[model samples]
Each structure stands twice: as C-alpha cells, then as structure tokens.
Target: MGLLSGVLGNASEIEPGKAQADFAQLLIQGERVEKAYQLIRDSFVFTDKRLILTDVQGMTGSKTEYHSIPYRAITHFSIETSGTFDLDAELKIFITGGTHIAKRFNKKLSIYELQTVLATYVLR
Candidate 1:
C-alpha cells in the first residue's frame, strides 16, 4: 500500500510538469513566430520599388491563411493581443510582378536557423 501511494503521488506530479513544459514551449514558439514575421515585414520595400499585388484576402483555413496575388509579401507587420492567451498578427507585402513566394517556418527551431532565415530574407 505504501509503494502504491508513492507511485500515485509521483504520477500526479508528472502531470503538472508536463503542463508546465507545454506552456513554456508555447511561449517560446510564439516568440519565434513573432520575430520571424517582423523580420520579413521589415525587409519589404514599397515606394522605392515598384510593387503590385492583387487578389489579397484572408482565407478560412486550418492554419490561418492570408493569401494575396502578385504576393507583394509582408511589407508591414503588427502583432495584436486579442486575449491574455491569444495573439493576432497582421502583415502587408508588395508583390513584384506576379510571383508570390510562400515560406513556412516551424516554431520549434534553433537559433541558428532563425538567424539564417532572417539574414537570407533581409539580404535578398
């Protein structure tokens, strides 16, 4: 009986630890996402360059798709907090010609990858 009680107590502690880890991961991911978005948005040029984008609209989808044709691609970025735990981000981009390149980033990423991606985008 004593061993069973000890095991149950340990198991209960496991749940809180797992939850804490999950929450911590969420925070980290959120920060990464925000940083990536900002990097992309800041790199865009509008007036200095002639950019035209058409058919821009937000679509209803599983991963929050913001689609635009001519795909100017993230000229402006803003992060808004809808709730204590919810974040909303808006982005504007100027699509050059008719080509829109889409890039996807993972939240669980290393610092090296983050730096590389930002550098690549900004330098281009």
Candidate 2:
C-alpha cells in the first residue's frame, strides 16, 4: 500500500517466501504455512490451520506482537477485487474476540488465490 494508504489503514502483500519455508516452529504440529506477506513492517502469514499476524513495534522495532487466529475464529470476511476504476483490491476479515483485520492489495495480486484460501479455511 502507498504511504497515504498506510496511514489510512491500507496494507500491501508481503512477497511470499520461496519454497514455503517451514513454519512448524511457529505453528502447531501438522499445520503448514500456505502463504506469507509483509504488511508495512509487519508480517501477514496464512497457514493451513490459521492466520498469523506479526507486528513490530518501537522506533527500532524493539517489540513484536504476534496474533494467531484459527480458521474457526473467522466469523466473516469480504473481498473487493480491483476494477477498471479501482487501482487496488481490498480484504476485510472479522473474527472472534472482536478482532478485525483489513488490508489492501496491489492490482496485480491474485483475487482467486486469496478467495481459495478464505473459502477452504474460513468456510470449512
């Protein structure tokens, strides 16, 4: 997301890691990482069993906040695909514990891929 978007709560995808580096250390046994992205200075990671959000705080990135949400916790989600008049796609998710996450994607991001992940996980 652009600087303006960032301040406005806009987020961009973090380039996925090559070979989908193992996340077993971060995930419960048998869970796997499906995708990863950087949202500003934070990390947005999607896994087979949950979504992991990593936020770095402090001017020097001295603090880190890790949020893990299981698929079962996702109560609702919405997606807006890029269009002729729209330069970016957006996603919003509402989950248990009153948690809400929203992010903006560049026009090049694949809506289908994201849809698949949401459908298979959140809808299961």
Candidate 3:
C-alpha cells in the first residue's frame, strides 16, 4: 500500500478538529511526520520515460520507466498532544538530504490540507 494509506489506516479514529489543528501545526513546522514516508516515495527521482533517444546505428532505444528509488536524509520529528484524551496530535518534521530534492521544490502540502483531503476521500 501507499504511504498515505498506511498512515491513514493507523489514524482511523483521529478526531476532526484536533486533526485539523494538528495538521496546521505540522505545516508550520515542516511536512507532517505521518506524511514523510509518502513524501519521500512520491518524490523519488527516476529517468523520464518520455525522453527520446536514437542510437548511432539508427535504431531507436526502448522506452524505459522506473519508479521510487531510495534517497538519504537527516530527519527529526516530534509528536505531541494537542488536545485532551490524546485525541489530537501534532507532528513536526525537519529533514535535510543531499540527494533529496522534494523540499527544494516545495512540493509538500500542510498536514491540515492533507487531513481534509483524506477525510473527504474516506467519505466518498
């Protein structure tokens, strides 16, 4: 299963308002810890499948496609309670990697947005 699916499965009972607040905090701090694994996966680098090339022999190269390759990072995260009964949790993440480019591209979204989107998906 995908990274988001795994995290959502673990967070099935998460409270809505609490989740939203936690998510907002996550965005402020960094990409949510829960979403970090997926972010890495989604941001994996691979050769462009659409790249075209012709060999010297006048033969066309085969279309090649690859997905999800591991990259390294120095990452730290914290999970804290945001509400009573442990129904709310906030996650903060800090990551640095020489080979990782996702953060540079700013492709990640706030946890609040991710939570809302997940909730919507579940409802549907």
Query: Per the 3 Å backbone cut-off, how many clashing residue pairs does candidate 1 have?
Result: 7
Arranged by TM-score, best first: 2, 3, 1
lDDT of 1 by residue, 1-124 (tens): 1234333221111232333343343332322121222121111111111221122234532242223221124343222222343222222233444433332222222334333433445345
**lDDT per residue (tens digit) for residues 1-124 in model 2:** 5666566454655545531463445767666677676666787888888888888999999898888888899999988898898877888889988878887777767866887888898887
Listed in order, each prediction's TM-score against the native is: 0.18, 0.80, 0.21
Best by lDDT: 2
Model 2 accuracy (lDDT, Cα): 0.76
Model 3 lDDT tens row, 19-88: 3353352233432222222222222111111111111222352443333221122243334443443333
Better of 1 and 3 by lDDT: 3
Collision pairs in model 1: 71-95, 72-94, 72-95, 73-93, 74-93, 75-92, 75-93
Regions more than 4 Å wrong, model 3: 1-71, 97-124
Q: Give residue 90's error in model 1 in angstroms.
A: 12
**Residue 28, candidate 3: alpha-carbon lDDT:** 34
Tell me how many residue pairs clash in candidate 3: 0
Q: What TM-score does candidate 1 get on C-alpha atoms?
A: 0.18
